[model samples]
Target: MKESVSYAPSRADFTGSPAVAASSASDGPSVKSLVAVTLGNGLEIYDFAVYSFFSVIIGHLFFPASNDYVSLLLAVATFGVGFIMRPLGSMVLGNYADRHGRKAAMTLIMGLMSLGVLMVAFAPTYKDVGIFAPIVLIAGRLLQGFSAGGEVGAATTWLMEAGGHSRRGVRVSWQMTSQGGAALLGAAMGAGLSHLLSDQQLYDWGWRVPFIFGLLIMPVGLYIRRQLPETHSTTAASTVANPALTLWREHRRALVLGILLVMKGTTTFYIIVYYMPAYMVNTLHMPASISYWISLTAALLTLLIPFWGGRLADRLPKRKPILIGCAIVSFLLIWPIFATILYGVPLGYTIALIAVDQILANISAVAMFLLVLETFPKAVRACGMAMVYAVGVSLFGGFAQFNVTWLLKVTNAPMAPAWYLMFCSVVSLAALVAWRERHHDE
Candidate 1:
């Protein structure tokens, strides 16, 4: 089941072989690799998070409707439209990475993402352009979704390969950290804008600022990514014409398990990290400013806490037990936690409760991530990871906000999120128990 030879050669191995040392040196310094991956991935996630953070205003501007609920629903639905392109992107771009090189795919992804960001940044309003505004906005989201589809796979694969097996845990952990950092930055901007701008101002022009800022930063990320040395070994031989085909034929079980494993993390992450602020404003009737601040706190926790999760993952002998523990505890606690929030808890208590959910989420997410990486050999790493992640995220994470919004609106149930998370936990735990770990750090 293993590839003929390992794709990730250690630093020592690189230095010991003259040709390899020369090639590895060409790959750029380790610090540069880290920087490039972090910057590119962070920007993609930042743009995505910014859109979610400002979805309400975006709904008003581009998805204008008579009813506020309908408008917001349309906006979030467009957000979901982005997910429609994720699987295609994963197959195309991921196959390219598997064949060509991670560096090339990373560079290409940056260009695609930058274009998407630009579309969203200067998109005209529905009032100004009539029906064309939503069309343009939806196009931008689709492009962004496509670019993001390949981004995580290429970036995480590069990190794991560049850092070697001994350092895989911390390096791969950076992928989650970058996402958290992006969300943190987005939350801060959201809070700052809500504090400074009036509702009318935010509705008119303020929502576009983050996308514009992301566009401006794109060139710098593109430049850094271009400088990265190729991580996929050129000497490795594979006659498989299509990485996706190889994956489906040889690794179908891993693919299924990976998707199921990612479901819990992706669903919980979108709900808490992206959807919570809106939930506070619309459902709990909290002030927009307070909601953004609360979101800021959650983002900060997400950015800082996952490193601990990564380190713990590195130290653990088995990922399954702890992962199961996290899921079980989550299933048990989610209902009561939501009940407490619905009962009008104090601000501090609410923040604490959200923090609890995040901690469990971060730990289990990191553990599952490493487990998935090890489930496949390097031959199909990029496409394998990309396909599963894209499918899982598209199915669960993409429409999570829309679903919860619809659930709460239709059922008049305050605990809709809790119900959703509990169900995800059960599914994830079942997948974890069925997963057979076939590889480990060598």
Candidate 2:
């Protein structure tokens, strides 16, 4: 029942020895530094999520196929394609972060993310460039995917390393909080665009506005990231020719279990936060604006919930209790939530139900993230987190929308997403139960 792999930290495992005393003396990173790191992450997520928010128009624009269904499938597939490069990005950038420094890796990814957004923001239409239109769009996604692959790992590792041990849970929890903020900002933009713009106007240019906004703020992120203190020391282990090999050889169980542990969160997030807008518009015939507003509301609630969860993580003796509780509750409630939404419940009630689910999912997700962060020793922390996060997201989260779209077309089952989430929940629960806990703090 017990796993052989262990991650007991040594003195070198401290992210940076100099910062430990300073961090422990206070709560965590200075507000300015914390804002810089989390803000960059939020912008990256906004750029990524904006694509899904406007997938319908994006489909009609760049992917222009014979039918609407095929066009949308192609559009979402392009979205998923970006994820295909995540693992590679994680390996390259994650390794770079480990070898160079967290500050260096964070600064580098900002430029790459900006470049990818530029391509999508200004790409020519299918009508203007024919095949080259989609080509440019996909190329942009690939670049974004690559940049993002290493982004989360480096950012989370930095927070963990820079913050005090007692506050690590709340510190790492900001990763999820930033994502919620991204979704919140993205949804507000979507809802506003949908409300203010006509169909012709929205399809013509409204979709590009968010990406352009992301580009405008990216320089600020890059500048701020450069000013942050380095969290990773360039030790001899970091200079290893092949950190990934060492990760696999020494931490195989953690990698495997971590991937499985991440599956439910990624799948649920992409489906609920990204795919639901399309599902409501396409399947239920709801107005796009209504879906956007609903998503906006959920994103707002989710944004505030993670801090509480983070606090809970800090208060608990072990993270497993909250993780298991949330998983089991989510598994039981998912089908009913979807059923209620489909059964013509009041729109207000529907929003409440979605908010409830998001709250539960987010709490568990925060706990899971903290657990994974502690599972790897500092030497390979960035690489390990990047690999686990990127692989799980690329394989499941990246394609969740596309898969559900295909399922609806084939099975015509409105509950398709619920079923998919259920299966993922079972897998996550199994992994959680099997996981051997090591409370590094304790």
Candidate 3:
């Protein structure tokens, strides 16, 4: 008779003792784990930022048109196309992460992101392949959208769970910090390339350099992510069941509120930070290099402020800082800040205003992410966060630049983006207030 095989959970299969898990999680993540997870996030953001900063040049190469404005609009539209795939990516990958292990999901998405970056990096321009060029570009952007859809949820959850309940605010802050770093790096690259290359040279070939550089970093990101410890091990068995349905049935309220809250962050980020350089160049007629540098400065401030905001979230009521940040954005600063940029203020003044705007934005972002991290249980945390964030970004963040451009063109109002930002802030503030009250009752 053949010996019967028996299956048993291994040590790695177990989520760790409750006491041990709690102790380790609250104590904060080791530098190794933090760096490993965040590196992938940075890579993802770097790819997106590179695309945004170079959209004008890319427009000429991929979607040449008789009219310059139309060509640029097409390129921006292509950029938004990637966002369209985000919700679907979120559903599939988010569900996978919730069902499988965070480590496995994270590793897989990094590889997917790498493939997308490679597609864009190597795609032939319209001159080389005619219609196929734009096709290739759109395909790559869709792949990236899919990969990114699930990235934030998996990464943020990993950081939060690893950080423990107590220090989750500080721990998850790295998610935004990594993004800010990517923005800074992307801006610096654009600025350097703009300075070194003639306009024709940049349009012809220089734009592809950043995409290639992003591909080179993929292996490093993958290797680092593979070494990360799993945080959702506690839900290993339970997660095998469908999490998406569970999330909708049980956490629908949280999901809706989460999306609303995320709208403000995504809009503010895309508009103020990512879109600033383009706005300066296209609308304000600033030198591309100077615009890139100004954006780099704001990105640097954005990177620094989050750590402080995270620390404050740890010490104070998370909602207070968030509310204050929203108030400042909605009621006081948005109009004047945009006015400064629109009216052709001195470069130093514009940069200073941008820095202050980013600081307030970062504070609200840190508080919001921390709140979301704490709201969901581990079993469906990754899926829940991914779905909400992806949807919010798809609707608001993805189209931010497109909307701003359209608004400016149709209305011929320089303050169009500012009004949009203020509107989003007000909506988000209402959602935050509701969320705070709901959690208080619970």
Candidate 4:
């Protein structure tokens, strides 16, 4: 394993001359640049997770339905609305990144994302603004959806391109790592605030605090991104005319498989990580603070597992790890784990079950991301990735929470989430098999 690990060659190693190497070393991607490229993704996911975490309170303020369940459903539905705009954002901004540059598209995306955060953070409540309150919230989510549509493709492609082929898995894993970090941070904030504030206080104004914090850091993300060196060169971009059309005509099979691949990861992610807090509080009748802390712990584990998985990918056949991981999740983990949680176990037991599930799920997730990155050509990589990601996440991920909630309600079954996870795992595994054969032929 140690022998297989590849490091990026330094300027000194490449140049042979000491003085030239010293001067050129500063030109490569610095630690600051890597952080800058990933910062927007981290912050974008933080905003989205925070909204989900506080959905119960947000429903009261924005939707205000007579029945609490209806209000909560409406809030989650609005959250899904943001995903609907992601495909459009992918087409518009993803094409711009492919044709113009990743840096330019990223900058514009952050600006639009910040505007959406501001609207959500300070929008008038339903009581104060009547029907317009929900309208404003929807507009904000649409803007965010648009921004997020392009974020994954641009950021991941830039990281892979900048790191070169040797450590592509390590580089691409950082995108998901950043998202895990955001989930951790959001969970921590919710935990801390829930401890400090009363239910009335949390519902009234505490829910807005996380969004406000996100808004404050928006400028810093923008400044950092501005300093990033362009990974795709001008000459290469000029050679590709109509990259989107080319992707559609030439890479249609890759696109379909990409969507299926993304479905398992995104659905599992939303249910285990994003929806855990709600599941604990609403279903298990756990305290809000305790639920947040459990989620926070699982999130911390999620952040660490991907890097380990990426290292394994660099050392082994990527497809094998993905298949093994998916098998564990679908066959071994899902039903028994959810049953353990539903049977009213100790808090420690519940946390352990969740942590194990997340670790297995993330291992496959990092491998899938690296596979997608390798599947597309560099010229249209960003657009192709964005389109597939946006479409898959919109269709499955956007409705993940809503579907779970609805299923639980209709069936009155604690194991409903497990069934959903099982179905996604099967679909994704089939997609992985298809991609492996197709890639072999190519």
Candidate 5:
């Protein structure tokens, strides 16, 4: 099973790499350089998500509200603030990458996030600092948001920019795996932290541990990133490719289309990944440890998401499988997904159910970027991608939990998320129909 899951696709196997002119002497990344980019991606996602797993605890400490839902709502809203900042950073960083170089932007974004996490780790709460407590937390999250908005856009730009034409699919596929792994790590750390502390202690200061830990990881990632040479050569020849000025002129439509597709993904992602664990705790009476354990086990079991869909794209017609995967997630997941939630499920059943949902979503997730790589032409791809993807995530993905909670409260449905996902599926289907295949290589 592990062999099948971790099957490393060779360069000879991937014929989907983007075009470089015959006379152009473009230098693609070495295998080692690709690994660094992908690892950096994984670390960034882990650092970003660490805040969410500790949401309840952090909310209590920083926001200090009496109501459970209110505190959580505040923390989640604060998380949303990061999302709001993302698109702006995309404009700034995407342009910066386009103008300066992907490497410089990547380095700068990492440094910003490292400082943000460091601040959060040692931050004083409402009890200690009054209004300023939450203020600083928000500021740190905003910095994280800015970095995140730029980091992936920059890293992805580097990865896609640096790959060989024959194997862009497979090479970029390896680049995608880090996100799932990082998410799994964040869940594991949250669970481990839960185990380490008494409930009172967790409420007191234990929640801050994950923030500190995430800050510490930045240096390790920085060290790994140091090995890879700059993906974009910082030369005078590409001076016309400044991202801020050019993204609008060169990549506008690609950016717009990207938003629609990514919006579908962001909506579904919050349903299955972000909010599901909290739902388990609230509706099913699962302990924090159990929720963490189940989610982690599920993440571990289906960890090869990038490769699974990526290999299919490498060999088969990329469009059908990609579209089908989206349709399946949009359509098949809602009923059973929420049905299991409503049922008074035991631990075993809950774990199985969550694992299945992860599998369904994972099946189509990497196609999100695969499609992006294909749609946008090379020079402006980074800015185009960042703009559309970030906005889609912000408007649709960022507001997911708050929206559903409000809907559930208003409509009184245990399966409100199912309805929401169904709607997103409808949107994804529309996107699939509208999206043309960009198999210029074919």
Candidate 6:
């Protein structure tokens, strides 16, 4: 929807992409500083991703529609509530990061996310409170969403701002390690616990335990984030400048391109991390255990892509890895990962395909945090990142499950949703390819 960027591309700024050097107060980002910041950013992701894995359980507890499908929709919509509020959180939090300090923003966002998790863990279910059950869930997700929105931008930018030269790709790779690890850990608990619980017990109180445990991780994430260095200075001059306005004026083209690029990441994550779990269990009749286990393994394995992608970002034109990875995803997008699972593929095949799919997504995904951070100047960077990211996630990623579920219901065909995901993939890739950004660093 936004215009593509138009500018002369920058040259590759690093060699061999070893660990990058940080910006000296006199210089720019150094490699060690980027690595440290990324490590903290990774923990922030882990704190939030813990929610997505519990979608089905939450649906059963909070939103109890008579029909199972409707319940799923409601639960996801509740989840999307968090996704929807993220932009507002990002706008304010991003401003705070740009004005106050990245370290403060990281700590604040992570702390808020932890509070949201704790609330959800303690919330009474529909069985206990009638309509208030879902209301509470919605409120909790919004809080989580707000915090998560800011955390990604601030923490990720912290890493990019610090990684002055080499290994930017490698450092950025840590950003997603949290994503995979969170999914991996949450899935293990959800699937394992579900297997142990009586259906009644699970539907009743079993679900809250995981969320309660998620709260415990907050202090840890906060502790790590607190230890990371503040990557940028929010001087009065930069603070007074309206970054959103500045981005619109000077970096308009890059702003549009960045938003479109983010759409892909948003789409891919929902489809894999959020939507696939239900699809695998409901449509393919794959054991839910298999779905969760595969996700766990995939997330753990791909944790290194940000680091590797950062290398690519520094070594090649950022555009090369960005476009190439997105292009591959375009081809792979047309087929649903679970389409073959319906054919009764072996569990091993199912797991292998999921792993490979996640890997492609990882490679495609890792270049983004740095790409967006670099797209804008430091002054308006957070605003530019937050605005674009908020819109993409709200429209494309947040409503993902509902969209796919509706697609399946309308077509009355099993293969319809797979094609739908493919359509989204094509659309996403098209935006990337058609982008007008003149940065030849690709």
TM-score per candidate, chains pooled: 0.87, 0.88, 0.86, 0.86, 0.84, 0.80
Model 6 agreement with the true structure over 1-442: per-residue lDDT tens digits: 2223322223323333223222322233444444444543444344445555566777777777788878776876676677778778777888788778888887888778777877778888888898988877777778888876776778766655653334445555666765666666666776677689887887677777777776775576677767776767766865645566666788777767666666656666667666666788887666675676665556666664544554455565545456656557555734635556667767777666666766666766666665566666677666667777776777777776677888888887877666766666666666666655432111
**Pairs that collide, model 2:** none
* Model 2 vs truth, CA RMSD: 5.5
Candidate 4, residues 1-442: lDDT per residue as tens digits?
Answer: 1123345555434553222432354433555666667777798778877787788888888998789999988998888888899999888888888888888878888899999988989988999999999999999989989999998888887877775444455566677778888988886787689889999999888989999998998888788888777877547635377777888899889898889888877897778777866787888787876676666766787777776666556555445556556555555677776777678677787678777777777777777776776677777888888888889998888888888989999999878888988898888778777774222101
Predicted candidate 5 versus true structure: per-residue lDDT over 22-135, tens digit per residue: 112233555445555665557656765678778888888888777988998898778778887888888888777766777777777778878877777888888898999899
Q: Give per-residue CA lDDT, model 3, range 126-178, as digits (tens).
A: 99989999999989889988998999888887876674344555677778788
lDDT of 2 by residue, 220-282 (tens): 888988999887778784455566777899888988899999989888887877778778888
lDDT of 1 by residue, 35-117 (tens): 56767668877877777678888898888889998988798788788789999999998888888788888999999998888
What lDDT does candidate 3 reach at residue 238? 55
TM accuracy, model 4: 0.86
- TM-score: which candidate is best? 2
Misplaced by over 4 Å in model 6 are 1-57, 64-72, 126-131, 196-205, 286-294, 329-333, 336-354, 434-442
Q: Evaluate residue 378 in candidate 6 and report its C-alpha lDDT on the 0 to 100 scale.
A: 72
Rate residue 338 of model 6 by lDDT.
Answer: 56
RMSD of each: 5.5, 5.5, 8.4, 5.3, 6.2, 5.8
| Candidate 3 weakest ten by summed lDDT | 1-10
Off by over 4 Å in 1: 1-32, 198-204, 234-236, 286-294, 409-411, 440-442
Indicate whether candidate 1 or candidate 4 has the larger lDDT: 1
